[model samples]
Target: MVIFSVLYPATPGGRFDQAYYDDVHIPLVKEAFAATGLKDVQVFKGLSAPDGGPAPFVAMVHLAFEDAAAMQASLAGPRGAEVSGDIVNFSDITPIAQVSARD
Candidate 1:
């Protein structure tokens, strides 16, 4: 399995609507990528670091896919564009993305 993670770095005065992310954005992602072998989606909201300092990322989203090829195919389609464009609706932070294989 492949896990695609998108991390939103914390910034001073950053704005993230958690409600919208959970209620709207996530659903949109599921709808957009479900057919391309998307298996599951998980979202994390950052609270604090080990030292009680602010977390590096305000939020993170992990998407599970059947394989790398399936993930690539999903991203190559129009749905990818739609998903990417929807980011502005909830947050102002530019997300950093990573793809990983299950250990």
Candidate 2:
């Protein structure tokens, strides 16, 4: 499986509406990518670092796909724009994305 992770950094003055992200954005993502081999979605909300400092990211989302091809196909399709464009509805921080293969 391939995991696509989107990480939102914690920045001063950044805005994040966790409630909207949880209630609206996630459902939108699931709906948009359901047919493109999307298997599961998981979200993580940051609390603090090991030293009790600000967390590096305010939130992170992991999208699991059957394979890299499926991921690419989904993102390259029309729904990708819809999902990506919805970011503004929740947070202003630009997300850092990474793809990883399960060990």
Candidate 3:
């Protein structure tokens, strides 16, 4: 399996609508990605840093796919564009993305 991650940095005045993200955006992601071998998804909400400071990121999402090729396919085509474009509906911060394979 492969993991595709999206992380949002915590800006001083960052604006994120968690409710909309959970209720609206995530469902859109599931719908768009499921057709391309998306297996599962996990979400994280950053609370604090190790030293008790605000976490560097406000939130993160991990999408699991059948394989590396499946991951790439998930991000291609019109459905991918639809999922990506929905980011503006809930957040102003640009997300950081990474792809990794399980050991």
Candidate 4:
């Protein structure tokens, strides 16, 4: 299995509006992600810093896939492109994406 994560740094004074994101954005992303082989999805908001520094990101997203190939395929697929657009509207900056597995 593989998990795709995205860390989105908030703008200088930006804060995420959970209500809108959960009610609108997430559903759109979920629909788009489903078309790109998404298995499960999780979203989180950073409340505080564990490292004694200001939290760099206001939001984080986790997406589970069957494997690395599946994650890659999904991101490169048309539906993924559509989903990516949602990110732009949701955040002040581009998100940092990473992948991990059982390894």
Candidate 5:
């Protein structure tokens, strides 16, 4: 399987309305990707940093697919466009994305 992971750092003085994200944005993304050939997805919030260090206050999102081609296909699909539209509402800063293969 292929995995896409993202780390989204919020802007300085950032304020996130969790209720909206959990209720609206998350569902929208799930539903949108459902239209595509979405295999699996995972979302997480930064609660604490390792070694008690300061965390980045990031939202970590992970998407799983059958392969790189499946991931690309989903991104190029119409539902991908819809999910992309909601990105701006989540964070003010750009995210870091990477792909990995299962061992």
Candidate 6:
């Protein structure tokens, strides 16, 4: 599987509206990539580290696509623009993203 991941760092006093991410942003992502071979989506809310320390990140997202091409398409064109533009509505922390290939 090829996955696109966007991770929000846990910055001191940073703002991340989890409610908006779950209620609104996620749904928007779904609709935008529905036709781009989006297979599934997994959203993670960082709670704590193994030692119970602060989590390194506040949120993480994994979006599964059919392949590299499909993943690329998901981040291109008009739909991609919509997804990128929606970030400011929810959080202020810049997300770290990557594309990975998994077995």
lDDT winner among the candidates? 2
What's the lDDT of the predicted structure labeled candidate 1? 0.92
RMSD for each of the candidates? 0.9, 0.8, 0.9, 2.2, 2.0, 0.7
Number of backbone-clashing residue pairs for each candidate, in the order shown:
0, 0, 0, 0, 0, 0
Report lDDT per candidate. 0.92, 0.94, 0.91, 0.77, 0.73, 0.92
How much does candidate 5 score in TM-score?
Answer: 0.81
Candidate 2 structure quality by residue, lDDT tens digits, 1-103: 9999999999899999999999999999999998998999999999999999989899999999999999998888889999999999999998999999985
Stretches of model 3 off by over 4 angstroms after superposition: none
Which structure is stronger by TM-score: 2 or 4? Answer: 2
Residue 7 in model 3: shift from native, Å?
Answer: 0.2
- Model 6 off-target regions past 4 Å? none
Tell me the TM-score of model 6: 0.96
Predicted candidate 4: what Cα RMSD to the true structure? Answer: 2.2
lDDT of 6 by residue, 1-103 (tens): 8999999999997899999999999999999998988999999999998899999999999999999988888889569998899899988998999989888
Q: Tell me the tens digit of each residue's lDDT in model 3 across 60-83.
A: 999999998898898985699899
**Where does model 1 exceed 4 Å of error?**
none
Relative to the true structure, candidate 2 reaches a TM of 0.96
Q: Which stretches of candidate 4 lie over 4 Å from their true place?
A: 51-53
Looking at model 4, which ten-residue stretch has the lowest summed lDDT?
A: 85-94
